[model samples]
Target: MRFSMHSTLFDPDALPFRRALIAGIACVAAVVAGAMLADQPYLIFAGLAGLVYVGTLTVNCRALAWLVIALQPAALIVPFFPGRPFWWELCALLAWPSLLAYGLVNRRKIEVVAFDRAERWALAALGGYVAVILGTMAYRGVGLRIFGGEQMGGRVYVQQLVLSILPVLMLLAGFSQKQLRMAMITGWLLSLTYIVSELTFARSQDMAPLLYFFELPVDGLNFSTGYDASGVRRFGSLAAVAGAGLSLLWVAAPLRELLGRWLLVTGPLMVALVGLGLGSGYRNVFASAICTLFFLAWVQRFWNPSRVISMVLVGAVMVGGLYFFAKELPLSVQRSVSFFPGIAISPIAKADAATTNSDRVEVLKLAIADSPKYWLFGRGFGMDRFDRLPVDDPNDSVSMLYSQGMFYNGFLGTLLKLGVFGLLCSLLFVWHVSKIALQLGLLVRRRTPSEWSFFDRVCLLLCAQWFAAVLLFYLTNGDVTWWMQSFGLLAGLLMACRRLKQDEGFVVDSDGVPKASVTA
Candidate 1:
């Protein structure tokens, strides 16, 4: 009763014509794509093309993989700015139509959209964070005057508007399995770009040796340096700096597989990483890098325990030998060419040498003392100044309280902002979503088939990035920029992942490409 003419439909020799078409498609797609997805029409077209592409997916993976990994950073990043001459952007804008068009050509069809626990948490968190931030603003008692109404009271309601709309746009993007793979590959490419630029700044080197694969002119970019002297690395998009480090940390690690052990030598990716570290000049980047590595190592370890133990043992032996030699060395020798200080026995200690831990801890304590207020609708959102007047506060606590506003606006506004119901839901959502991602990650390895796909891996990466960024942001800078952008990206990424997971009809090849490949 089967429709196939032969029993060996999956056999390599059976589908010669289909395979050839797929191969031909792969070779020509990139060369043909020379447009950008700019403006509202292009964005809509991009979404529709994604819809069509997902529908036509057939599963000849080799070529499919090529398309997913093909996008260059210049294609996406440049168009966001006002003026940039890039044919690639035009191609990206137009290529989407081809994906949809492929469905009509081949007639394979699928209907899919993704939704899951992470999306729910993102929704809850975005609401809660905004409410709390705005509530703090209102509690200062000039809430009405600042906005001229009961509106958000931040410095710029505009970025807040962007933060609000971004999630909706992502939801509209209509994620599919192919999209997720494409995104991860994109993430890897961009992360590599950022790291390379950072490293160039550090060593004062040419970007060609670092990012020559794409032939981008990487010279003279400010961040061409590493971690940054201020221990920060801000991105061009938004005033935020927290997530870029996490992104770099991640894209490099999973990317190591693509590079293999040869990354240690003169690999393009390796050069980019080195340039990022050197260019930033910030020690915090090093900390974030360590955290990223440790997380990756732990994840890999979770899958392969014996390999973990062996690596740990080897590392311990090397450290012990170094310590023993340092102890036996003369003071003059130690002073001149010592391998480490007593604390330098660990890499973390060595990196922490030029950092200011005690001062940050002190400043954080000062910031926290003015918190935990009780304002139902407390301070005005835009009222963080010293009451726009000179205050004579002798003590740190009093200074913080008065500087918060002329009068102390306690936690009442916090209640109105959170509204009691939101607070409870926020707590529950965090508990649930965190647990789910952790379970799914381990389950994808231990319980589910190894066929969990690229989108799954990318979602895992997004989670890892968020977690790492949260840790680093808390330690480095507690600015609103850190919180807002982290949550914003997290929200957008989650929604995109949701659409990918929920939609199942798109047939994907092993490397995360659709077979029919969008010809546009």
Candidate 2:
């Protein structure tokens, strides 16, 4: 046999490949049985989901896995208009059965990567938190109703657990270093696309229709030309802004030296897109993005003596330029910056900003007030706003009014729902992941520029972004576990990569092929 480097990348005869194939076949058999017996039309959706996931697992293509992961943000952000199912949930939900089947069949092929001390502690904390939630639910009874209002049985509890755990398990079992790199690239590209689309369509008369078609929020319609009713267009709302900010951190990090020279041209374009996207009304997103950049720079040692002068000059120019041109800047952009700690703006704008800021403060206050009542276990996990809202409500305004309640300050909500103990565990989990990301960043920074491969560098950046994304999301939006789970999956894969040392273990290369050095 020839010793072509690429040849080992896709060895179908490999045990993992064969095991994945067998599991897929079993899934197909089940789908066929379901169709024959149940005769439900939705079985087709299930079949499609199963087949695609089976193919991805068996093929072990890093590109395919990343394509799916990259689309996750869009799936979450994109609207699920009237009569449409939230495809993001559907996509995530349908993927689990096939992945579990593959995992069981390939159980022996699965390498149980040992968690380091910090990771072990993190996992233990998370497990304990979940146990507390479940215990409290069991004792008080689980329900769609808050606290002791109504006991709806264990259906919601079980569903929340499944939803939360499925993605984490999939990432742990399915992803590799190569997929992580591709996910970073895809995430960046998608974020760029989102900003470009938002900017390009901001002034269009048909903006609402276009956004509706894509299931994006139309942002209000009462504002000025090109502005949403809130006087800003939050293309993907805070999520989109947060995603872009994370992407920007990657673009600005000291890691740029490791990326290809081509990024020199592409890099500025990305920065511009992101900068323009963080307009007025996106204070939280903007703050998160700025804080993350500072964090990345500090960790990467962006303040080395050699670069101090350049850093100061650049900072001066950015602040000065914006200050000088503040009036001429896009209203949205100006409004975005107006709420910064010491920015000055018109009295009306200032009042508007004050009102907006107070909403969050009030929500936090409300959460704090409610926390003491159920401080031990917190409100039950996965309390959906839709479940609380009447399905028969004729008031079109009800959805808008209650939707915000769905995610009210996610960080505070977590504290209120899970109690201080659960919140501490959640923070511990985040700390562990952040520690790993910081380690990766420091390692990458110390690497001789030429020694760092495309795969390694991108993986590091993505892990960092994933860490930042979760932190920003947790502190602000706090919703379902999907986004957090995505980051956790990234963290898990990054940890695996670190421990396995791709060149040593039975690891696949950047091309998704098994390395020749890895023997059975």
Candidate 3:
């Protein structure tokens, strides 16, 4: 039986609540006393408070969603220093308890689906990997020596367990379609915040102190104005820049009633998109965002043919503009814009854009070569780097000079840690997410005029962008386990929201509220 928060039996203010409150107080007292006796009561109260805060917030999924959205960027920056607990892991720990309590109170059951099964399978594979690591540590009887020791192994083991499993569980436990939109809107707001912060940092001399005062990462902040060795001024990390472009792309494609058709078709919206891409020096991110926009336009072609045509025309113009004005553009912009010169149908041409692709290919080859030796189960986590005998050859130069680690590649890293079986499980998880996203995308496409279509479309766009980011990161940034963990969380939440939408059998109205009747 579902119990509302207002019900006398469930409400904290009611008579029965006093007994429950007394028990809770006793438990808290017992915990505190035990901690004190153990001589480890430090920060216990603070930890308890944090738990209470998260528990309270998660009872409302909307609040939880917003919290998740806000935490995304913070998670990347806050945990920069070593020996610090990850913010998202803490979020997961607190969220699970509250999620369980809410589920018990409301008598909610987990709905089983194909994707959920895939998620479980993935979890099991990860569990097996952990088990192997632990078992090896035990069997070898390794000690606490830090370097290449069991202590380091244990830490790596624990870190992976928490990051890999907790986020997925937290999202799967609680999320709805409304919450999904809330996350997307929050993401957009964050993008705008990034833009504002970058502009401020560039324009103001004293902004560094202000940014530091707000606990933001000052050194890593990129305003897309500084040039690299190649004279390219990349906006930010691949994910950050791609995410910013995604925000602009979502709104750029459709301004339905807010602006005229011509504006949506050929004017300011398109200009903003190009500006965003040019500003972000990341070629992969720009291409990914543009591809996502094109995909969306293609999907909505039946509903909005003019938008599609406009996008095609925009691409042609972009190519031509790059060809004619290649050198006229800023050096940073020219570095990216010059890629179109070869196919621009003009005499003007420039060398193909510079890249680290060769370095990445070398790393991938190394990963491929090492995969077979550890084919069944991997050497264990945190042991991705190795020594190669032929390292002295000047012709065989690679980024990893002293000790070779997989550089700018994650698939190899995954294979190095979890082996072929684990790799399959991870791939299954991706397959499941892709399937659900496509289904949801098709649903939104068919239900043309539905009120929530815009939000759904954005979610679809985000999913595509996410997939692109994954590919980009795998190829160009090996230390993307952070990204993968977060992706797992996002995919789980998205799937959960899709499940809720399917079960509810209704459509959102113009006011952005779900209506009882389903849209045709």
lDDT tens string, model 2, 315-341? 677677667766665555666677656
For each candidate, give its TM-score against the true structure: 0.49, 0.67, 0.67
- Candidate 3 has what TM-score? 0.67
Report RMSD (Å) for each prediction in the order shown: 14.9, 10.3, 8.7
Better of 1 and 2 by TM-score: 2
Candidate 2 matches the true fold with a TM-score of 0.67
Q: After superposition, how far is residue 462 of candidate 1 from its true place, in Å?
A: 2.1
Model 2, residue pairs in steric clash: 9-513, 79-215, 220-229, 280-332, 280-336, 410-478
Which parts of model 2 are misplaced by more than 4 Å? 1-68, 76-88, 133-163, 166-177, 192-213, 217-234, 237-271, 346-348, 381-411, 442-446, 466-486, 496-520
lDDT of each: 0.42, 0.53, 0.51
- Estimate, for each residue in 43-115, the C-alpha lDDT of model 1 and write its tens digit: 6566567656555443322233233233323323333333332333333333334434543454433232233
- Any idea what lDDT model 3 has? 0.51
Encode model 3's per-residue lDDT on 298-411: one tens digit a residue.
444422677557657866886676667666655445554544526332122122243334556666676667678666765454432233322445344354521234445666
